[model samples]
Target: MASDIIIVGQGICGSLLSWSLLQKGISVKVYDIDADHSATAAASGIINPITGKRFVKSWMVDELFPAADKTYSEISQAIGVHFYEKLPIYKLLESVKEQNDLSARATETGYEQYFTNTDVQYLDKGKVKNEFGSFVINGGGKMDTQLFINSYRTFLKNKGILIEEPFTYEQALVSKSKVIFCNGYKAAQTGFFRDLTWQIVKGEYLLVRIKDFYADRIISGDTTISPTSEKDIYYAGATYQWHYETEAPTEQYKNEIIESLNKMLHVPFEVVYHGAGIRPSAKYRRPFIGFHPEYKHVGIFNGMGTKGISLSPYFAEHFAEHIVNGKELLPEVDVKNILIKS
Candidate 1:
């Protein structure tokens, strides 16, 4: 079938890019196998404005968060499926130093949006531990990644643009339409865009069910625990491993998550699922966007890393504008500038 663009991979990148393109009246044919190891499938889809050990604001949060909210709402309305939600984050302070740091950050001029509640928030003593105290962070939420992806895939299928198969470099080279690779870490493996530098990371997580322990908001401490649509089930512990022998889940990481859960929760829980995925990150920590230098017809929209939920929608719209209306790509994320160093 003829299309304006052919997209490889149906992860968050591919899905959002296609959505953006479709909004611009562009036709797209997507290629993907929906592999079990998809990073989007394993992601908890937490969009936390305040992150890191220092408890500072995430990069580009002000711009990215609004774009995410708009794009997700648009897609949800179009598909008639509700997957995006704005939930507060309950950041549990681990030490006195962390408490002091948060206190200082709350006094900062621009941090008031996220750090509104400086008072220590307490939870039920039997349900979860809050000895060191915790604070509520606004301007953050969770995306039901699986639901969004599934609903959008169905949307594409109805339009006859969804091709459930793997697309390789050989096919990409000869495709009539411009081909864009939205595949995750496997893009590094293919070596098609060899000029780009990558810092691939493997992340693992668990699905646990705690009886009668319901969390209305995301609980963050040693690990993040976010509620799912299913009652009593929550996502926990996405460990970031810079070095790993394989992309598969490990017992060590699973146990580590269990240990953290034990420390954070006073109630007993049952682990129902374990999963992992490799995240393709750029060395400088920005998405790799734009066509390849040599192969003008080939393009990429990957390397979103841990911030895919926050980054993908806004950047997908940006990338789509560049393709449709001759808009200049962002200087920081454009691939031309990124490859010059390599």
Candidate 2:
């Protein structure tokens, strides 16, 4: 019997989407070449409740956070690998204006959840530079992207549903089951969804080992410093380049991250790894989740951008519902609506 669906690309998006469908008793065959430096692997996996220069809550944080927490927890138990961690974010204030802005924003009605206590002072002056003080943000955490993806891939392989190879559109055309492309920025280069407005971004980061510096929480300064599953090794990043010549990691970006680390850390650190990945940001900064307008069987669940870690699980379940039951897709995320607006 033919599988219910064929998922192309086994990144976080693809992994979660297939898992969601499988949990609903739908059979799925996943195709992926497993590139060495994909976007999912390079992600810092930091889920901040607030974002941007204005320090406003992230887009859809209220719904996204709860869904992410529940889904990651469920998947962790299913796979027996603890990958999701709820940790506070220590945001170092860059200037007095920033401190004042946050102080004022904290008094607002809805902002109190993330900024309940801004009086937390930056105490480790000897270890970290704190010329302007900082605050601890609640409802922020990190996901072990590598562990989750790798272990889940293994789980799929054990089930004999994962096919390790390049999947082309021609194969998708001939497939008996519905095919959804979960490929990253590469989707913009080829396939039916190429015409859709794509704001492809290239992000680069560094993996560093800082001796004698212990951080149980995520540190957000000029660059975000997130802990990994490994001891003493942290993921520091990242430089966002809206226009870049290549997806490969450049020395210039590596030095740029090092400079930011120097500004925040008083201690010396060694660069263990440098990586880069291309993000598939949509025109309106939303995801594309639905079937194509013309070719109904060919669908997409890409364009999660930097928020793939938090967005995937929620959206995956949503897309699965749309596929399983006759649920209406949100106008913002519905590809038909998005393409019509564009």
After TM-score superposition, what is the CA distance of residue 63 in candidate 1 from its true location, in Å? 0.4
Alpha carbon deviation, residue 266, candidate 1 (Å): 0.9
lDDT for residue 340 in candidate 1, whole number 0-100: 69
TM-score for candidate 2, residues paired by index: 0.96
**Candidate 2: residue pairs that collide:** none
Off by over 4 Å in 1: 1-3
- After superposition of all CA atoms, the RMSD between model 1 and the true structure is 1.5
lDDT of 2 by residue, 199-220 (tens): 9999999999987675588888
lDDT of 1: 0.88
Assess each prediction's global lDDT (C-alpha) against the native.
Answer: 0.88, 0.87
Those runs of model 2 whose alpha carbons end farther than 4 Å from true positions after fitting are none
Task: Give lDDT tens digits, candidate 1, residues 1-342.
Answer: 346799999999999999999999998899989744588878999999988888888888989999999999999999999998999898888888877888888789889888778777887778889887888899999998888888888999999999999998998888778999999888888756755888898899999998887568999988889999889999997999999997789999999999999889999999999999888788888999998877788899999988899999999999999999989999889887777656
